[model samples]
Target: MIVTRFAPSPTGRLHLGHAYSAILAHDFARRQGGRFLLRIEDIDGTRSRPEHVKTIIADLAWLGLSWDGDVVHQSQRLSAYAGALDRLREMGLLYRCYCTRAEIAAASLSAPHGAEPIYPGTCRVLTRQNAERPHCWRLDMARATAIAGPLTWQDHGRTIVADPLTAGDVVLARKDAPASYHLAVTVDDAWQGVTDVVRGQDLFAATHVHRLLQALLGLPTPAYHHHRLLTGPDGVRLAKRHGAPALAALREGGSNGLALATELRVGRVPIGATDT
Candidate 1:
């Protein structure tokens, strides 16, 4: 059966943007006669809160989005992530990176525009003994990119492809954290049997890295649909920083679930338009 998921980091309440994504996933799954699943991306233990998770679940339920199975939490799957990292290590596709955030910031500032501080492969040459240092673990960008080749994944109305070698090595797991977003997301999507990824356009660039991870790890690459992101009246992306209203807040304001659904479907329908 076709499977899709709406994975959300429980760092904040489910805002309208989230609602649009979740509803899209739910509706798509239903249309395909497939299963829609929910996954809690609470890998960031520092900022993810139990309350936020609970609120996200409650809000999705209120929005009439139901799932077939229990929600999966990324934090509970550290060993799986470690296993993937170990496989890459055995293939000599992983190295240690000791650069601190400040150093990376300085390097980026020194680099020319359109060029992200392409990791200089500083730690890629570390000796086996040095690689054992607690602060090490970097991707072998050269090997990964070569293996990944020129790959493409589908997105809403467009196709995004990348050259693995040029995409740069991304951190899979940090010395302080067991799994980074890229690593965890790739694993979760594969394990959950997600056949399609429906998310915002803002993440289009990250798909390149995700595709690379899939290639390195031998996981199935899901079709990606990066839909338009919701924006506030100011034309900026809706975010908690700008106080973009959340679904729970709308619920608390006495808007029923159906009304909220209409709000989510607002822009697509012209004024005085009727549903056939």
Candidate 2:
């Protein structure tokens, strides 16, 4: 049976963009007589909140989206993450990254993309036996790409070539958080036997790295369906970081979820519509 998942972090409230992503996964699964699952990506212990978790569940239910099986939380799967990390480390594809966020940004100032910078391999030369400060583990992109060999993943009925090297050496596990975002999601999707990955097109690039991880870890690759992201009046994508309001707020304010859901499904949300 086709299985898909909506994995949301409990860092903030679920907004219209989140609703669209979840609805896409749930509706697709239902249409195929398959299963739709929910996964709480709470691996970021510092930002993830229990109250946000409760609010996420309420918001999805309000939109009439029901997920199969108990909701899986990343915080509860540290051992699995550790095991994956260990496997990568054993293959010499993992390395310690000692650069702070500021340091990385400073080095990537001339990088092609502004603000969101790809990590320059600075601490990549440092070995595990090196005398240094607290560090995080990063996937050795160059070595990892070479090891994984040529790769590609199917997306929306198209064969897309994987170019994980551009993502740079991504963090696998941090000192504060046992597992990084990329590692956990890749591992969990395989663990849950997810057949399809449906989410925003914003994450289309990250699929390259995910495909590499799947190959390196000997996990099954899932077909990806990257849908259009819900945007605001300014044509900007809705983001929790940009202070997008929670769907629960709309529901509490007597907003019609069924109507909002229909609008989203038809891709015709009203201007300044707060119902969803």
Candidate 3:
């Protein structure tokens, strides 16, 4: 059976963009008589609010979408993530990264303007470490890629070659969180037996890293559908940081959620929404 999931972080309330993604996953599963799972990516304990999780469930239900079985929370799956990290560590594909954000930014100055900062692998060669010093774990990208060999994954109908090197050596475990987004999401999807991953196009690049992780960890690679993002009046994608209105706000303000969901299904977004 086809199994898809909508995994959202509980750092903020669900907005229209979230509703669109959730509805797409839910509808796709229902159409195929598959299971739609809901997962709360709450690994970031510092920022993940329990209240936001409740609101997220409420917002999805308000939009007339439902999921099968119980909702999975990443916070409750630390041991699994740890096991994945341990396997990588045993294979010598993991290293401790002690560079701070500011230091990493300075090192990545030669990168193209407006591009994401790529780590220069300063810690990859570190022969000594202070047990007292706090450090995050980074994947030895070169070694990992060498071991995994060439890899590819299905995106929509296209077979995309995995290029995790573009992301440099990514952090797998951090001091603030037990597992990074790349590590947790990749592990969780496999553990949940997700056959399809329906998310926004913003994460399309991250799939490269996920593909590599799946190969290294001997997990299944799910089909991916990176749908276009919904934009606001300013053309910026709808996000909490972009000041997009929350679904709860719209729902409480007398907007008919069912009607909104129906319109979204036909690509008729709300006011100020622009297709990307």
Candidate 4:
């Protein structure tokens, strides 16, 4: 059976963009007689809050959406993530990165503003061992790509070539967190038997790295649907950081959630809101 998931970090409440993505994934699963799962991406221990997690569950419930099975929390699966990292390390695809954020920024001064600076492989060749120093594990993209060869993944219905190098060598495990977003999500999706990945276009670029991870880990690749994102009048995408209103606020304000969901399904966004 087809399976999809709506995974949200518990750092903030569910905004309109989040709701739209959830609704699309849920509707697609239901229409195909499949299962829709909910996952709490609380890997970032410093930022994740229990109160926010509670509100996230409440918000989704208030939106008139139901998820199949119990909710999956990323925090509870540290061992699984560790195992993946160990496997990659054994394959000589992982290396320790000791560069600080400021140092990386200084090295990436030539990169465009707001663009993610590709790591210059500063730590890729370090042979000295510093157990006392803090470090994160990064994937050697060049070496990994050499082993996996060319890769591709399904986006909507098109087969797009995987360009993991575009993001440079991504961190698979961080010193502050047991697993990076890229590592945890890829492992979780495969473990959950997720067949389809329905999310926003903003994440379309990250899929490239995910495809390479799948190939290296011998995990199955799922079909992907990069749906349009919801934005406000200013054309900026709706996000918690951007001050997008929470779904719970709309629910408590006497708004009809079922009606709102209906309008969303038809691509009708709220006043001052647009989909892009």
Candidate 5:
């Protein structure tokens, strides 16, 4: 059976862009008679809020999207992420790096595009004691890619590809956090049986890291569809940072589900067309 999920970070309210993605996933699963799941990506504890989580669920329901199964929250699955990290460490596929943000920024001055401030393998040679210094855990790209070999996965119904070397050394666990986006996302997708992923094009570049993790962890790789992100009138991506209008705000302004569906191009009728 085809299984899909709409995982969203609860750092802010759901906007029209979120609705577009969620509806797409729901419709895809519904059309295929499959399952649609919801995952709350709240691993970034510092920025995630309970109110935002509540609002996200409510907003999706208001937009007429229903998901199957209990929602999976990433914060509650730290042990699973830690176990995956441990597996990588045991295989000698992870290293510890103590490089601070300032150090990386200084080194990035002359780095090439998509390769800014690469890890430089700073701690790849560290002894056990040296590795114990205040540092984050990074995946050894050379070792991981060697094991995974040439990596490729499906994206937007196309074959998307990645080379671990060009992707560079990825941080798996920060000093202050147990799991990064790469590790957490891979684990959650497998655990939830998500066979397909429908997300924004902005994340397309990060697929390299995700493919590496999936291969290293021996998890099934899912098909991906990276749709065009909804942009504002200014041509910039809609986001909480720029104060884009949220779905909740629009609903409060008396906009109904039909209006939202029309704006997203999912409604039966056109936006400004009148009924006969």
Candidate 6:
């Protein structure tokens, strides 16, 4: 059976973009008689709040989307993340990173593919230590790619080559958080038997690293459908930082959730929505 999921981090309330993505995943699964799942990616305990998780569930339900079986929460899967990190450590593809944000910023150089600066791999050669020093875990990208050996994944019906090196050595586990999104999402997808990943194109670049992780971790690579992101009138991406209104707020303000969802399905903007 085909399985798909809408995994949302509960750092904030759900927005229009969130509603669209959830509807896309839910509709895709239900249309094909497959299973749609909901996952709460709340591993970042510092930012994740119990109330936000409740709000997310309420928002999705208000938007008329339902999932199959129990909801999966990332906080409950720390042991699995630790196990994956250990596996990477056992393969010598994991390293301790001790760089502070300022240090990494000083070394920031714009990546050719994206405006985001890639980590310069300063901590890749650092001596591994234990609890004495607080450090995050980073993937040895060069070594990891060498082991994976030319990987690729399907995206929107095309086989795209994975170039994880452009992302540099990504953090697999943080000093504060047990697992990074890249590690946790890949592990959970395989664990839940997710056959398809429907998300926004803003994450399209991240798929490169995800494919590499799937190869290294011996997990299945799910087909990806990276849809266009909902953008503001200024064309900037819709995000909480950009002051996008929450979907629940919109519904409370008298916007029709089903009408908005159908508009998104037909590649149109929601009614009274200033954002496209």
Q: Highest lDDT: give the candidate number.
A: 3
In candidate 1, which residue pairs clash?
Answer: 95-138, 96-137, 145-164, 145-165
Model 5 residue 82 CA deviation in Å: 1.0
Q: Please provide TM-scores, in order, for all candidate models, with all chains considered together.
A: 0.88, 0.95, 0.96, 0.96, 0.89, 0.94
Candidate 4 deviant stretches above 4 angstroms: 272-276
Cα misplacement distance, residue 90 of candidate 6 (Å): 0.6
In model 5, what are the clashing residue pairs, if there are any?
Answer: none
Model 1: per-residue Cα lDDT over 226-260, one tens digit each = 87887765567666666667777777766676656
Clash count list over all predictions: 4, 0, 0, 0, 0, 0
lDDT of 6 by residue, 1-276 (tens): 889999999898888778778888898899999999999999999999999888888778777788999999999999999999999999999888888877887788665553656889887765656656888999999999999999888888999999999898999999899999999999999999999999999899899999999999889999999998887667777777788788868867777777777786766665457532
Residue 23 accuracy (lDDT) in model 3: 91
lDDT of 4 by residue, 85-129 (tens): 999999999999999888898887656888877788899989985
For 1-276, candidate 5 gives per-residue lDDT tens digits of 888899899888887677878888888898999999999989887889999989998888887889998998999999999999999999988888888977876765656775556766766776764655788889889878888888889876677668667667889998877899889999999999889988888787788889888988999999988888776655676666666678787766666876577567542322322111
lDDT tens readout by residue for model 2, 1-276: 999999999998898889988999999899999999999999898999999999999999888889999999999999999999999999998888888989999888656764468898888875555537788999999999998999989899999999998898998899789998889999999999999999999999889999999999999999999999887777777777766667987888888888888888876665556424
Better of 4 and 5 by lDDT: 4
Selected candidate, larger TM-score, 1 vs 6: 6
Q: So what's the TM-score on candidate 6? A: 0.94
Candidate 6, superposed: residue stretches over 4 Å from native = 111-115, 128-130
- Model 6 vs truth, CA RMSD: 2.0
> C-alpha displacement of 65 in model 5, angstroms?
0.6
Global lDDT scores for all candidate models = 0.78, 0.89, 0.91, 0.90, 0.81, 0.87
RMSD of each: 4.3, 1.7, 2.1, 2.1, 4.0, 2.0
Better of 3 and 6 by lDDT: 3
Tell how far residue 36 is off in model 4, in angstroms. 0.3
Model 5, global lDDT: 0.81
